[model samples]
Target: MSDKPKTPLLDKVSYPADLKGLSREELKQVADELRTEVIDAVSVTGGHLGAGLGVIELTVALHAVFDTPEDRLIWDVGHQAYPHKVLTGRRDRIRTLRQKNGLSGFTRRVESEYDPFGAAHSSTSISAGLGMAVGAQLSGKKRNVVAVIGDGAITAGMAYEAMNNAGAMDARLIVVLNDNDMSIAAPTGAMRAHLAKLVSGPTYRGLRHTAKQIAKALPPIFHEPARRAEEFTRGFFTGGTLFEELGFYYVGPIDGHNLDHLIPVLENVRDAEEGPILVHAITKKGKGYGPAEAAADKYHGVNKFNVITGAQAKAPSNAPSYTSVFAQSLITEAREDERIVAVTAAMPSGTGLDKFAEHFPTRTFDVGIAEQHAVTFAAGLACEGLKPFVAIYSTFLQRAYDQVVHDVALQGLPVRFAIDRAGHVGADGPTHAGNYDSAYLGAIPGMVLMAAGDEAELKHMVATAAAYDQGPIAFRYPRGDGLGVEMPERGLVLPIGKGRILREGSTVAILSYGTRLGEVLAAAERLAAFGLNPTIADARFMKPLDEVLIRRLAAEHEVLLTVEEGSIGGFSSHVATYLAANGLLDSGHLRFRPMMIGDRYAEQGSVDGMYGEDHLDRNGIVATVLRALGNEAEAMRILNAGRD
Candidate 1:
């Protein structure tokens, strides 16, 4: 009675082993069904739709030919692993993708044995697979290690490092370059152009076939030369010369969508006793879906959508997003200062630099998925007396810490870091959580770290970063929409190491950093209902500690609670350390508490849901206040009462 498409072939073949028993034609039918299933499941749950659809045939072919669970098949970025997940006995739970306590948006090793190495970040698969291959070889175990990486991922320097090492190691490894010619954004740099050229070049099918026949007829001495000639002939026409030079046996610009082209080529690669192999498969992103294929980004990530209309379901929000606020604020700053420029690592649109790019086309720089290079590049711009705002998500910026420390912080370069998603980003899960930036960056001596309380504050912080030339400064804002506060006509740069009191109260004081101020305010109102009015203050700067304000609050209030949307050793930790080191806790009259994200990694869910689960929401905050007031039983009762 259900309206879901009948996946008879897919249902019959639950696992890769089941697929091996089917004929080539039947396997092609299975790929079609698999593609349909992925679309349908994504329509229900909303996730990385296009990437999964693009790799349906390739997923089937790889699993069918190779022995998975035994053979390590690592997927780069893991956005394209939905079809792979479905084939690996996870079809029953496929529709729960990205939901609370359900499947992850990206591949996770804990989720399945099929996924050997967990990956959400790009360009890590090759390195992981190579390590596995080398380990297996050393351990005297017989198993294949295949790394399915995209052209976008391969552009990262880490991929090249892995390839270079793998090449020299001569380990039995297979690197499948899924050249869809698109990352999240359109691929950038010379590598993209090179991949495009290789795909459009002369066919290597005839040359490869002829070379194989000739090699079969030739003697052992001539075989090596004949093989080298074959490689050279293909390299000459199709441009896999770079891969060949890396000591990989290069094969194909094969049609990834076509099972006929894919199965045989994959079979040969699997059977071949080569040191290392690189298989180039040309496929269209969002291959089977018309709407996804026609879209600019190929619907790389999507909200739940109507399967028929392909119109995604977007949650209505009145407030502007934090990303847009940052973009507009930066743009306004740039209008006055000609030296101001913007830089992003692959995520021009995601980081809101695409708008900056439109206005100041020459000034906006997208350095691909290379964060390490992007940071040092911004440092160089800063060295030339240009104010460079390096806008990157906090999770991505973690990849460039060395550059931040050595090139920027150590040298005291004034490169502005605009860290977006500076809290627990829902749906994408722990892998993409921006929870550690505050703790990590705050540890650097000269680094000025600030968090925005709202959209208006974010604008001010942007202006503050633009005006500050003291040293390397960073500002963080959470994901999703603002708190619908009134926008300032123009941004005003607040004094460094300053905080503002929102309310005046006696018994308890709640000091908040970042957008968690809203929740703190709500909790303050709840406490007021229980005959307890708490003082609320927004500590603007995390690094400088706002010692004057903190010491005054500690001396005046009976209970002082420090709240932040970060890990343990963040704003709260700094406050606690400052309070303790200065002997503020010697009196024992003041009860100090630091509320933050706990010691464990949080699961994917709605932002509010995650916050509530972590007990950092309004109710949770109120409960913390109750416990601090010596009503521990009452605090537990309030928390057990449920969501506000």
Candidate 2:
């Protein structure tokens, strides 16, 4: 904490209102100090650094030019809003970002009134801002609504759909296209800045408005030609023809990082009485920081690091990560099978496809930020007899649920889904958690869902998915390391709808669906201290569950517990439905308890901390067993032992 940067100017700014009277030069100093503070904060508590750095000037400009608490400002993924958070009265909690009981990694309405809409996922800003703009119009409350979306986010169909509707209605909304990475077009210089200011200024807008009125008064044929002429003239100079066609007045390609260039144009756009406007600002992903600027993706999300050397802190672990294991396993399958190909929705690295791409470059496809399109594209590949592995994060896969249903599951396409981050994603918080995928995917008909109990099991699952060509099959794995169990030389293809028992017992049975098998085993070891020897079984498949094993376990054990790292309606729900349908519940001899993520969203913490808090960890499992065995006192003791 003592090593934190000194932000003298930023210290004076308590809120966006503090930026109101500051001159352009003073605002520039504030921006510089703000960037340092953000860098220092993220150096301690790692999170999205590059995007936030890119929008430092723009965030300052928006807050300074418009009233944020009243005038709504919606950030498209909220990854770029860290600077906005610092300027909007959350400066004190800046270091606690993404920590337990601390500030969220993204925007949350409950966290601050300045944050009107919450988002961790991308490309919903335009739609949300339009809704807010229409709501303000209906309430007779005049407020400037701005949706700052990145170029990558703008590629999604939802952004266009929202833009089309906003244009059609002529709603008063500002869509600031933060073109940081995707080179839309260069030509950014003094001339570009001047033109941006000129168009956004009152003189040009007034002249254009007068010309529109005159054009309306002319004969129909003449008016149509005159409008086309004016549009063409501007389109030739500025590459805004596409945005203009979508019913928005386009301005800029202006330098976004420059406070001088950004502030005035934002001020002009703020004062202008325009309905739907698009301001194209050219910024760098990691504007000020040298390391971040050099490599964009590395700094996009980071671990705590040494600020001076730009070296990140690496948590030492014995086992390889699930992502890496998945990548290697998929590569093993693809090596033998020429038809095996991979698809990723923007997350080539995060989903482990980048490694797969290294081995099979042409076979891997990175569909930029469009999960819906990626799913359908994979379906098309599957239709042609080629095996398409759509590797996507669990939270992101939810976006393409319809495509997963219609194009793949309903059609019974053999699309192998390698779902990473299948459980709570630690500090990234609830929005990024892979809690609902199990529930969502399990509900689809003809869908086969499997979870890995260990890295070895993940290998087997990958082989199984590759060998099976019956229907759509998915395998879920967590974000962290494997159990350090023995690694297989090559993956083995296991039978479908089958599970294996890890340990044997008599009175109690613990059926695990995912990586929580490690915890279940740990719980069994601890349960021995309480004179309770629980049977541990790894139910790899949630869908097409091993009914024979379930019936036998239910018959043999007095008490049964189902554990998973997913939401309520997932593995546990399926298990309960089977037991209920088979009259396992009618006979009062057996007691069944399903442990899952609670009905509410758990707060962000370490993966272990979050799981322990939700009572799904080893200690939690031990507590549950004792309680189920009528040892309530011992259960409470075990529960409180590790709890903070």
Q: Tell me the alpha-carbon RMSD of every candidate.
A: 4.6, 1.2
Q: Pick the candidate with the highest TM-score.
A: 2
439-499 per-residue lDDT for model 1 (tens digits): 8998899999999999999999999999999999999999999999999977999899999
TM-score of 1: 0.93
Report the Cα lDDT for residue 46, model 1: 90
lDDT of 2 at 386: 100
Task: List, residue by residue over 287-395, the lDDT tens digit for candidate 2.
Answer: 8999999989888899998878899999899999999999998999999999999999889888889899999999999988899999999999999999999999999
TM-score for each prediction? Answer: 0.93, 0.98
Pairs that collide, model 2: none
* TM-score for candidate 2: 0.98
